[model samples]
Target: MDPAIASKVLPQGLRNRLSASVRLAPDPRVHYPGSDFPAALADAHILISGWGCPALTGDVLAHAPGLRAVMHAAGSVKSLVGEAVWRRGITVSSAADANAAPVVSHTLALITLAVRRTLSMAAGYREGWPAFEARSGADGRTVGIVGASRIGRRVITGLAKADAGYRLLVSDPCLADEDARLLGAERVELADLCRHSDVVSIHAPLLHETSGLFDAALLSLIPDGGALVNTARGPIVDTAALTAECASGRLEAYLDVTDPEPLPADHALLNLPNVLVTPHIAGAQGDEVTRLGRYAVEEVERWVAGRPLLGEVTRQALPRLA
Candidate 1:
């Protein structure tokens, strides 16, 4: 319920629809005063949440006697949703699919640029025309995707349509062989994908098991001059190891997220010629936020009409999602 999200991101029509069907609390901050919230929640049948919405705790649930569903207008419900909501049988829907487009599009663009060594080429162009060689082309290059998450699948779809003759490799324990084949990618182990790929893009989630999944050893496995793209969480890859690899000019990275995000201005990563860092802007920018708001509104309408939501989150998926 951040003010910026409510006032800027959501469309007026969607906001009007939500206001009509749900009793929206006016506070834009994450948490509300106990007195203000308890009274408002008592008759609340559905909660529409967005960035900065308060965590739905057991104590909070105790106040909402009639709450049946929650519609989230953003990606990743892990931060706001807790066990209490699930335990109370409160259904939930997220606009993650709508938000995935920006990340997937960003990844595809990075893959194309990295394969062509665009960053280096651009730097050379700026430093006055210099003799250059077409060292690497996208033709016959291998693109390894770390996970077949929503964003990863979309990236594959775009890659499939590109003129670049790139062989696709995928690594995800949960991804079945049939699913990989359907995406036109060959299934492989994480290390094997890193070893064989000309460009490796990570789209995995940040969970206990996935934290620092790409450490020194895994990073070292990337063939020299190969590019690594991480549109996923920063903690998934060891920040220090990535900086070291890129600093040595043995690897190139297009990182949109990083551990301890917003790395200091003086961080070595900023100085590395082979590294391109973005401030976690890969997902849901510009008018894309309207997509998320519209999705949440539609989900709310579905719940009211007794239809199942298209973006329903299962209790079982929470463990792998966070």
Candidate 2:
């Protein structure tokens, strides 16, 4: 945790809850620091992590001989740990499940708006409301999910239960056909998913192979007026290609993350009414952050009691995780 968000992430109430199980760290700045970090590693057994915690390198680990585990209070521990942490055999866990709920809710909302042609319709409001033929509805629309990760599966489950009767297609190199069927989606190749889907929602993790996956060719396969929803990672989608499609008004996008994130002030995506680019606010925020804090606190309780960790993340699984 960064010193600035330490108090907020572990507020007084949550701090009290954690303190009941284990002694509280008197000063977060000791371990939560940047380039010129000075960690209080001596005598510490478990490290609670959050955003801005520097990577646990070998030199940093040398000081923490007793450190045994890391309970991350936020989503994605990809950048938080290194070979040093794993080499030490320290158990790791993430509060990503807590964060997923909000992202799922937001992705579903974007899908709803996308299927209804919200962006294009809103932009053309001055002319008049859409006529019967021009109006779109969620029912019978096809939504392709890019990866069957936790968030993607949850999104598919939500869609399956929705009254919209959405036809779901999933594309994940790691997913099996039977599992896709069980998740209430048809397994398809990425190209086929893009070609047939009315809305292509991205949930893939950023990997060397997946970077720029939704390039010009794949994006062009999406039917005209289709929408693209990405709340996963910024680099997964080709921002420039997406901008071209949206600018041509042949596609619409609901992007919560973008490559070269926080694009320049004059980025064309920002000016296009058909594209909605938000500042990575899809995850837990404001009051919702308490859930993540509470989730981490509960994980600490589990570890202290020798119970199974519900959010445990393993070194072997890191390559596949978001």
Candidate 3:
């Protein structure tokens, strides 16, 4: 597990629930050297994994005869669970919906801040006293959402609660016009969304077709001074292009993720006036881990009761994920 997550999150109740579910092994660090992990695999029936669970590979599987399922308590199981697990018929479920909450909350906050120029004003206020100016608010602000994924839909729902007059535009080939309407947004092409909206948020999965979707040409379409918020995988947007655009000081960005994440200690993005970068923490945190733990426990209960999994990942959707 990511040391940062294991240390801060993962409370006692959740740990106890997992322990009661299986013949849980001693905590890895206390029982075995990191290099000697696979030796204990034979005893693991279900791997309840989180941010830093060791990769489940064919070699690891060779030792675990009883392994049947992998319940991940977070989003994007791609990094830890691999093709071998799928080939071996191991059922998997991820708490992606639970994790989507924070990202949507973060995006919604950025949406309102961007429209009000909150960051810029905060900077000015801190650097030197500046005259107050009446400016436009979120009322009637146009927000363009790039994908209709879970996070995107959540953002739309949150936006509906605001008193600001708001109009939403969305683009996602997989989504139908009726679906977009139901989500309270108008469906439009990606280019049109970028060209017209005052704020744009990206929530697409990082797949072959979506990798670098926001290349130079498409990025250039965003109106100047418009805010671009990305909480998705960094590779979904062109890093070089984004860096250049942000460096120009003409566009504003609120990024929770970046390609080559945890940018070098002295990376220029850290100093940029228009860029707000956070170490990929848009997902669940604090008490949120409990939400995922409960999700996993519920799935386990369903499985034991001979019921279908509530969050099963299908083979058909595998290729569409990051």
Whose TM-score is greatest here?
2
Q: Write the per-residue lDDT of candidate 3 for residues 1-322, one digit (tens) a residue.
A: 5555553344566567655655457754322237555776678777667776778899988988888888777788888777888889988888787677878888888888888766666666767876655355777788999888878888887886665788999999999999889888899999999999888899888888998999999989998878789988888888889888889876788889898787887887788878889998787768666787678767776766679987777667866654
The per-candidate count of clashes, in order, stands at: 0, 0, 5
Q: What lDDT is obtained when candidate 3 is compared to the true structure?
A: 0.79
Weakest ten-residue segment in model 2 by summed lDDT: 29-38
What TM-score should be assigned to candidate 3? 0.91
lDDT per model vs. reference: 0.85, 0.90, 0.79
Better of 2 and 3 by TM-score: 2
| Winning model by lDDT | 2
The TM-scores, one per candidate, come to: 0.92, 0.96, 0.91
Model 1 agreement with the true structure over 39-153: per-residue lDDT tens digits: 5677778877788777888887888989999899898999878889988999999999889888888889999999987776666676677564645688899999998988888
Which portions of model 3 show Cα errors greater than 4 Å? 2-4, 7-10, 19-35, 126-134
Q: Candidate 2 on 75-169: residue-level lDDT in tens?
A: 99999887888989999999999999999999999999999989999998878877889999888899999999999999999999886879999
Error of 1 at 75 (Å): 0.4
- Model 2, position 25, has a per-residue lDDT of 65
At residue 241, candidate 2 shows an lDDT of 92
